[model samples]
Target: MAPSIRLSPAARSLFDEPLAIAVQGLGPRQQVTLRTSLRDETGELFQASARYQAGDDGRLDLARCPALPGGSFSGLEPMGLLWALQPQKPFWRLVKRDVQSPFLLQLEVFEGHGERPGRLLAQAQHERAFLRDGVRRVPVREGRIRATLFLPPGEDTFPGIIDIHGFGGGLLEARASLLANHGFATLALAYYQFEDLPQKPKELHLEYFEEAVNYMLQHPQVKGPGVGLLGFSKGAEVSLAMAAFLKNIMAVASLNAPVAATCIPFSYKDKIIPAATSYEHKAKTTSSKFLDYSDVLDDPFQAPGNQSLIPLEKAEAQFLFIVGQDDHVVKSEYYATEVCKLMQAQGKGNFQILSYPGTGHCIDPPFFPLYPIGSHPVFHKRAVLGGELRAYSKAQVHAWSQVQAFFKKYL
Candidate 1:
């Protein structure tokens, strides 16, 4: 009998869900190479390979067998083939530009762990879909709101949540789609780098975000006394500003963003949250030839600089600060800690922080490969988004669960 690759369930599955992998009908104790390959919407190839041996029973279950070194990853990672995948192109991050489509994965088994695997004995294909079958993807084009709303299937109404991507711009619906699968009617909102919006806007206004919050609260499929905000990088900073001034905001989940308005100033109704002085002149060049932005943004704790700090004590929403300790892109952990002190001074305890050491910037949904470095979305220059792959992957999974639980409990 020929060896065959098998996926535990049907080939169709959510991008965030994990599937079992195994190779059957192989010779007892046979050494083989397992490779997984897939192309993003852009036609860029991403692939991973692992070496393993069948048990005495002639079955190789990834859940039971530990992967050997000298491959993409090693040890007992059942879903390593998916997460260990790296792009063939340099500095290319795997992004799901169109959530309406699925990423098809090709899995193959070969005879040995050579530069070229000896024989292609087994092959299987799987589709990692972004949009769930029952979930509805609706494009939002209300006044001043350029976004996509994702609602769970059926007559049931889900809690409302707003998801914002980084300063890099564009509407990223993948995260919102995943959250909608778990019963949150999420809106992936875009502020810039999108249709008719400027690529390099000088100022960010919270009024635009306020419109999104109101839109969510008023949505028929969305349930809310208030809505939650989930954001990354500059998006997180915007969330913080909205939380501070906007009404009916139940929670804010911030990922690796500044505590104070920086890079770009944020403006509300009448006043402005002044941003720290720019210090691009002070940025250090990393060994990888990318910029290390760890110290690029000025500190918010010092005098005059505190003028840019957001006063979250005025906010009615609970806060969840997810920090990556080794994040060279920004001082995430430091910001989280100082904010805690400031909140304590004001006698407010509406914030919960989850800090992960060795984790870097860019924490996406679970099982996605780690993006150690990429061009800064705002700068268009290569920058270090530091992290150890395994640690960052683990952080991504745990942080996602924590965020869901936080939203469920509070929002």
Candidate 2:
């Protein structure tokens, strides 16, 4: 019989879940090349191939077989299939194409390469998840904070989260929706702008976010002694502050975020959290002639607001800070380090820090290519985001997994 390929989860696989691939019906000890490819929304094609030799039974099991030479990666990395792909443009670009859409991965095994190529050994296609099926997307509009809720499929309660976005306002549904697929009840909170909200970032009230926290705790789909906060950039600052100021926050995860409040003023019951000291320096312009703030970042200690850090000592929630050393928008590593130091100085032990080198400011979910340089979506200017593709990709994967594990353990 001809060789055939089979996938364990043959129908659909979650973005963060692994799939097992097995090849059977091959000649004893046959040699073959397994090729994987996918196309992005922009019609860019990415492909990767690794040579392999089947066992005496004419079967190749990805779980046990080590890939031979002639591919982007040399050995077995758990998620090698993702990073191993040769990009026509960049991995980040491919991920950006349509994060909300499913990705179809085409796989084929060929007997050989070049002109002496043998017959096709096996071939298969599988739908990989960015947003998995069975997830319930609910609109949140009951309180002061307007947000969207994502509940994992089924009636089982899950650890809850209040997700916050950065300077570019508007509820970023991608991250929360993706996390929900991984078994969390997530609320993507919109602070300013978007859907009958404030037109711009200004006079922000922390009460709105507090209301979001209350909403998450009260959600039937949410399992909570306390919920968690997942935030990026300015949202990260809010996460830190919320864990310190609010009640019932079991944990906080800040991604490439800031130490001080940013852009707009944050107030809760007449208490104000001042914005960071920001400096605007021109780097370059995008094709649309927008100025890029590649070289400029908030200058810590340059303003009185920087002195008013979130009281880490008061925060009872566990903390995880994911920092990119090469982040161009903020000194993420420095801020994360200082936060750790302050926490330690205050005898707080509930914090973990992971800093990745060669990574940039806007670190998204896993497998997304390194957008080392790009035009800011809101600022509308091109600038260096800072990250090498390989390191950034690896960081994204590790950070994403770590976050899920963290929530499972603490929330």
Best-matching candidate per lDDT = 1
Worst 10 residues of 1 by lDDT: 296-305
Error of 2 at 40 (Å): 4.6
Evaluate model 1: give its TM-score: 0.98
**Tens digits of lDDT, candidate 2, 299-322:** 553545364566677889999999
Quality of model 1 by C-alpha lDDT:
0.88
lDDT of 2 at 146: 84
Model 2: residues with Cα > 4 Å off, grouped in runs:
25-33, 40-46, 51-58, 85-101, 114-121, 130-134, 153-157, 282-295, 301-308, 357-359, 377-379, 388-394
TM-score per candidate: 0.98, 0.81
Model 1, position 303, has a per-residue lDDT of 70
TM-score of 2: 0.81
